[model samples]
Every structure is written in C-alpha cells, then in structure tokens.
Target: MLFNLSRPPTALRRSTSEFLQLCRQLPSARRALYVTSRSKTMSEPKVISVEGLSSSEANVSGSLRNAPRVHPPALMASVAILALLRSESNKFPPSTIIIEQYRPPVDRHVVGLISEGESPEQTAIRELEEETGFKASGVVQSSPLLVSDPGMTNANMKLVTVDVPFPENLEMPAQKLDPGEFIQVRIVELAKLRAELQAYERKGFVIDAKLDHLASGFELAEKLRQPKSST
Candidate 1:
C-alpha cells in the first residue's frame, strides 16, 4: 500500500507562494531561505502552555516570565564640559572653571547633550562658547563614558575639560544661545566646588551626576598634583 503526505492548508499555501514570489525579487533571498530552513530544522518543538507541564518546565516558564524585557531605543549621548577660564587677578587664583545652571524638563539642573555629527570634544567647545561667550582651547581627555542612571536609562555621558584664556586685553565674544535655553554661567573655584554645589542644591537645583563625577575628578587631579613633603 502507498501513502501520501498531507498537504498544507490553502491559506498557508497561498501565503507561502506569495512569500516565495516576493523573495525572488531580492538577490540575497536564497541565503535567507537556507538560514530559515536550517533554523527551523534545528529548533526543538516548545510547549507554550503551562498546563500539564513538569515542575522543572513550570519553573523555566516562570523564569522566562521574569526575564528582563528588551526595551526600545531610548539611549542618548550627552556631554558635560568642565571649563577652566583664566582670571586676571592677583588676589584670586589665575583660573576659574565655568558651570551652567539650566533647567531641564523634569527639574532645574545642569547638563549638556552632544549634537549630531559632532564629537564629544567639539560639543564641549561649542557649548562652552555658546553658554559663556568664551572661546577656549579644548582637550578631550582619555575618560571612560559614564552611564547617567543604569536602572532608568541607557544614556551615557562624555566628560570633557576645556581651558580658556582670559587675558586683560583680550576681547570677549557675544554669547550665542539657543532660543529656549536659559543658562547662567557661573565662575567656580575648583577648591570651593563642593560648597558651590551645596549652595546650588539648596536652591532647588538638581546637580547632574556627571557634574559631580567631574568635580570629584578635578579634586583628585589637584590632590595628585600636590608635591609630597620629604620626611
């Protein structure tokens, strides 16, 4: 006796025929078809329903349910410039850094985002000049990218340090700010950064984590620069 294999349903056959016709239009479709066929052949049949499953299988299902879900694209690239500006004063230090006080959508804070088609260093230089009206020499240090908040976002920040020269006779340029931006550039002493940050925090301004890290880095660098006294 001869036996015939069951044929696929008409709808499935039609769908397959249409898919094949569409695939024929593309050159790489044959490779895709081969991969799909191989995958399907290698894959084991999975029982989706929890009913009548073994304890191990049920546990596996539960684990799958608790698995971290892959979120959509919410990652963003940001830049924070720790700008050092020259001060022409004998009493005070010869240089002071600039930090901005700006409001974000959630709260009044300080941070900056890098623009498209611009490097981190470029973004820092541009933002520093735009916010403070000072053109400065910039250097992109070998610093690791920091995650703003690992739990909430995949956003990473690039911290850049820019040094600006302010000679007594040097002309200051006009600030080029965006229409919606309301930024106040404050000259901050590196030694008094903690106090300054505290003062800002008292005024309902939320400090960006990147700024805190940058400040800490500055302090550490200063400490390293201090000469050790010989015993």
Candidate 2:
C-alpha cells in the first residue's frame, strides 16, 4: 500500500503555524490526519502539522518545503538487486554491478529503490535491466525486509541476488534509465567488493547500511562456496 500527501484544507492552509501548534497538542489527531490523507488520493489539498512529526519526518518535511509538491508514503518499501554477471567461457571471474544515482535531500549516492507492486525478484530483474542492461536468470538468495533508517523513515529494503550470464565477446545491451535518473553502473570483481565500497565512502557518498550488510553476506557465501579441504 502507498501513502500520499495532498494539498491542505482551507482552514489548515489559512494558518500553517496554528495548525502545527494544534498538532503538538494532539499527537493522535496528527496521526489520524495522516491516516486519512493517505487512505485515499485527495483531490483537494490536505494540510499536515509538522510540529507533531517525528524528527525524521520533520527533516523530510523541511526538505520538501521549497518543492512545489510532496508525496511521501506511510510505510516505504524498497528492493536492492545484487546482480552477478559471469562469463560462460570462464575467461573472466564473476563480477557484480553497483549503481551510483542521485537521491533526494542528499547528494549523488549508490542505491536503488524498487517500484510499487513489484516483487523483490521482479524488482531485481527490472532494476538490473534498466540500470545495467543485464537480465537476471534467477534469484540465488533473498533477504527479509530490513530497516533502512530506523531513526528517520519507516522504510525497509529487501536485498536479492540473481545470476546473469555474459558469454565471451557478446555485446552488452543498452540501458533504459528513467527520466532524471542519473545512474552509473560500476562492475567490480567479487573479491574487491569491500574495497570498492570503501572507495565510494571516501568519495563522500553515503553508503547504504543495507548494502554493507548485503556485501558481508555475499562475502560469507563466497567463503562457504569454497571446497572443504581434507583434514
């Protein structure tokens, strides 16, 4: 389900400051207002009191104030694809692609968000193809919904890994990026994932904690894939 904020009511719009003050007096009322606004699309504007919002919500509100519109969901959910492309000829080791894109209220960064009504695997395939022009064959692993930023937004992200086959000398497909979406797909060796993440951090990009955790899990999986030696 998606929650959206529309324009404010006439009375609420008349005095934004007064509405906020009232919100501070009644937290339940504030939540109720949000519930109503999000339940259905509002043709007329719906006002919300920022005073009653949590710190994270307040921050988001502040960021959107200058913008002409704001539409935030009540419970945000996203999916990240850990795509692995391997050469069929074994000429090259398997590598994965991570995206660099611009995120709202923040500078350019590395992350991807799943679209609504799409399953994690479907999101994985769609995002992979759109962002990197590679189609995933199947999902190898999937993570439960993990909190992205508990303090700020109630958004959660699920991570999934899918296998991508790239035969030798095959031409890559063209990427289909969304409008205003500036994405750079960087392919890195599986073993050098940590170093690549660190490099991104050094460049002043806020690395998503979920990505770090997912990378750790991938590292463990790689280690486990190694054949056990006879004692």
Candidate 3:
C-alpha cells in the first residue's frame, strides 16, 4: 500500500528529536531511524529506545498513534529521484536539477515515498511520473541511502535519474502536488552550481545538499558538465 505521505503531528516533535539525537551515531543510523530495543530479562516486554539516542522510537510511536490525527507508518523509508536532461541548445549540459515539490498547505522535499509492499526503485519511478507527469524510460540506479539534511530528521532517501530533453516538453501539473511538499526547484547549470555552492538557494535544493549522502554526486555532476557527443 502507498505509505501515508503526511506530516507527523506537532506533539511528536519532542519524541522525534529525542530519538534522532541518539541513533545519529551508527553508520546505518544516518538514513534509518531508531525503532526499538529488546530488553533482555523481563516477564514484561523489554524497553526499546532510539538505537543511539537515550530514548527509543516505540514510545514515540505508541504515543503518536494514540494522539489525535496521528496515524501509523511511524517509521518509513522515503525514496526520491534526481532527473537530468540535455537541452536542445547545447550538446553539453547547462545543468541537471531535481524538481522541487509543489507546496501550499505544508512544505516538504519532493521525494518518492516507497510503499510498504513496494520496492524503492518502484517508488522512484512512480514518484517521477506523478510529480513530473513525464513518462520516462531507463532509470539508472545508485546507492539508496541518502542524508542531505542529517541534522533535522534521520530520513532514508535514494538518488536515481531519468533523463529528458529540455526546452519545454516538461509538462507537470505543479498544482497537483502531494499535500505538504513545497518545492523551489532550480535548473542550475554547472558553472552556476560551481560558482555559488554555499550561496545556492536551497528551496528544496537537490544535488548539493546531500553532499556526504552521495559519493557519486560530484562524479556524476562532472559528467553533466562535459559536452555530450552529438552522434
């Protein structure tokens, strides 16, 4: 089933923060959140806390579940796509950019949230189709775990690309965005991206944000910089 792509209730902030503070240590913990810990000795169930942080996720999940407007899917894997394109003007690239989420009521990055039974790759393709409304073929895969903004949430994201020609076949119903996903996508060329790394407006910035998350971002970005063969 498609995961509930909604915001956690306001009350859960304290809990989320507490748990993340702990699990931020382990390497896998970067993308995965703390779930539970099995208590060794007990007639009662063992206490589980965030993997690293002093607190665990179960407590938060239980509390959040009982809270008003709070649903399940307490911890979920969020997958996303990165689209690259070659414009008509130049054989090379002006740049590759990830489309920002369409926002109104709430604000979120544009990512393909994987369903419970679905694969991350599927989520990537499905999300791209819905968000961009452009039926793309051939999705190149990369390492799945992502950590652009590690300080905020322990969100597990992925990077994938579907190339398309630019200069205007891009038709997307920007108005019909998943609720809460606000976006400010910029189709920045390599020169600009290189010129202003720090100053780049991260209105849901895609490529550079997850600098550490992606070992390949720099390498791939370089390929985009080179002029493509016209053959």
Candidate 4:
C-alpha cells in the first residue's frame, strides 16, 4: 500500500535547517502513534513515504501488536491422562455368600456347610444334617457364593439355602455330623434376617454374594409369616 505525502519542494535537500526544526517539534515515544482525525481513533505507525518518492518506492508498515491466538480444548488432554493414572495395584476384595437352606416351602432356615470340596450347597445340606440331621428337602435355584472377606481373608466360600419345615424340633443325625465341630444349633426366625444383615453391615462384613442372592429370594419371609398371606 502506498502512502501519499505532499510533494517536497525541489529545494528540500539544501534546507537542513527546516528539517531539523520539524524534528524538534515532534514528540518521541516507545511506540509510534498515528492519530486519525477523521475517525478519532489512535493507531500504529502505518504508511510513510518521501513526498517526492514514486508510488513504487512508498513503504507500508503495519503494527504487529495484536492478533488473536486460539488453542484446542483441554478435555482431550485430560482424558488421555487417565491412562497414565491407572493403578498398578493388584489388591482385590474377597467374595463369598453365607447360606441357610430351608426345608420345602417354609421359613428361610437354610442349610450351612462345614467343609470344602462338597458343592457349597452340599455343604449346606450336610450342615443341616450335622446341625439338625434334616436332609435338605430340596435345593434352591442358584444359591449365592461369595468371598466373605475379600479384603483380608482367603475364605472363598458360598452359602446354599433351603426352607425347612419344623419337625417336633430341630434334629441332627449324630452319625452324619462331626459332632465335635458344631456346638449349637439356633433357630433364627424369618423376621430376624434383616437384622442379621444390619449387624453384618455394622461390622463391615462383606455379605457373601451367595448369601446376598439367597437373601433376595428369601426376602419378605416376615410377610410370608403373616397368616393372611398364606394359602
């Protein structure tokens, strides 16, 4: 872009006195300032040309002060950071389920186990015999299994449960049970299972997954206990 300046008088070169006088009247500053009287705006030094210079020789200089800079969103970078933060830890929680098998369609008086190798449900039935000598009338569908102490212990166990009808009293076949292993057989009422869960939670005991599932099936035993609900 060429700037138009008033033509210089042909006597310009010899008039050093006049140029020096003009320079003395101009103020010097860190940044050159150009005032546009037409728009009342301040701008950077722009075009400059010698009055006698041809348009081809004119100079156009623009201020490099301002130009907007844009950047990409940081979320992409943060999402990528998750991979670096992933843990190298192997610590894992234990899992197990506690079960009590019932006899037929009765209370949730489920069977428990005494040893391993027997299907966990088998242990439940065996415990029924050892504790009360009652054969599990039948097995429930898909009883829960768990690592009761996923955090601290290695007891990977499952609990199988069934409903047991009340006989004259809880009876154990002495021959089938390791009499030395079991000390007591207590009959917990259907109403007490929820309290039992609360107790386990208070103690920070992980409910055996097997028992958790069993509990779901056995839910509303109290409702079952209501005489009106029964057929």
Clashing pairs in model 1, backbone N/Cα/C closer than 3 A: none
| Residue 122 lDDT (model 2) | 82
TM-score, candidate 2, is 0.57
Comparing 2 and 4 by lDDT, which wins?
2
Q: Decide which is better by TM-score, 2 or 4.
A: 2
- The Cα error of candidate 3 at residue 205, in Å, is 8.7
The TM-scores of all predictions, comma-separated, are: 0.53, 0.57, 0.45, 0.31
Q: After superposition, how far is residue 29 of candidate 4 from its true place, in Å?
A: 99
Q: Rank the candidates by lDDT, best first.
A: 2, 1, 3, 4
TM-score of candidate 3 on Cα atoms, chains taken together: 0.45
Model 4: number of clashes?
A: 31
Candidate 2 wrongly placed segments (more than 4 Å): 1-76, 106-117, 169-171, 217-231
Give, for candidate 4, the lowest lDDT window spanning 10 residues. 77-86
Clashing pairs in 3: 22-52, 22-53, 23-53, 37-48, 49-56, 50-55, 50-56, 94-189, 108-182
Q: If both were scored by lDDT, which would come out higher, candidate 1 or candidate 2?
A: 2
Q: Give the per-residue lDDT of model 4 (tens digit) for 76-156.
A: 100000000011242222111222211221111223323334454455555555444445565554323444443332233
lDDT of each candidate versus the true structure: 0.50, 0.56, 0.44, 0.32
Residues 1-231 of candidate 2: C-alpha lDDT, one tens digit per residue: 011111232222323355435545654213223111114454643322122232356446433222111333333355667777788998678777766543333221123554577677787777777767878889999877677545444446666778888777334677886544444556777778777778867755656665676568778998899999999
lDDT of 4 at 206: 46
